[model samples]
Target: PRSEVGDLIVIFRAGAYGASASPQSFLGHPPPIELTIDGDEIL
Candidate 1:
């Protein structure tokens, strides 16, 4: 398990509801862009 080139991997699952019950336009898929970081300021 080794990664390079921008390395930022996090896959710890227990019921990870990524994309919030994703059904993106009922499968047409195109609606998942909501980020709001405060520390480094990306809001």
Candidate 2:
């Protein structure tokens, strides 16, 4: 995958730990969306 080294990628389940540990703000990334569920709603 060397040809795709700089392409955008999605790292599944990174939020479990990476989000908290990664210096996203310092890296200039916006805050990640948080999800919450209650009954039949997703907030």
Candidate 3:
């Protein structure tokens, strides 16, 4: 599947009340600041 041609929903498993260890996506570092999923960007 192409990364751009689909809807991406990032659900942070971390709690919203308690202090999170990392307020970013656990998938990687420098978490996603902004994301734009466009099929045009897909190769």
TM-score of each: 0.24, 0.29, 0.18
TM-score, model 1 to reference: 0.24
* Higher-ranked by TM-score: 1 or 3: 1
Report the alpha-carbon TM-score of model 2 versus the true structure: 0.29
Candidate that scores best on TM-score: 2
What's the lDDT of the predicted structure labeled candidate 3?
Answer: 0.47
* Alpha carbon lDDT of each predicted model: 0.60, 0.59, 0.47
Relative to the true structure, candidate 1 has a C-alpha RMSD (angstroms) of: 11.7
Alpha-carbon shift of residue 1 in model 2 (angstroms): 17
Choose 1 or 3, whichever is better by lDDT. Answer: 1
Off by over 4 Å in 1: 1-16, 20-26
Ordered from best to worst lDDT, the candidate numbers read 1, 2, 3
Which is better, 1 or 2, measured by TM-score? 2
Model 3 vs. true fold: TM: 0.18
Q: Per-residue alpha-carbon lDDT of model 2 for 1-43, expressed as tens digits?
A: 5547556544556556645576678668786654444567985
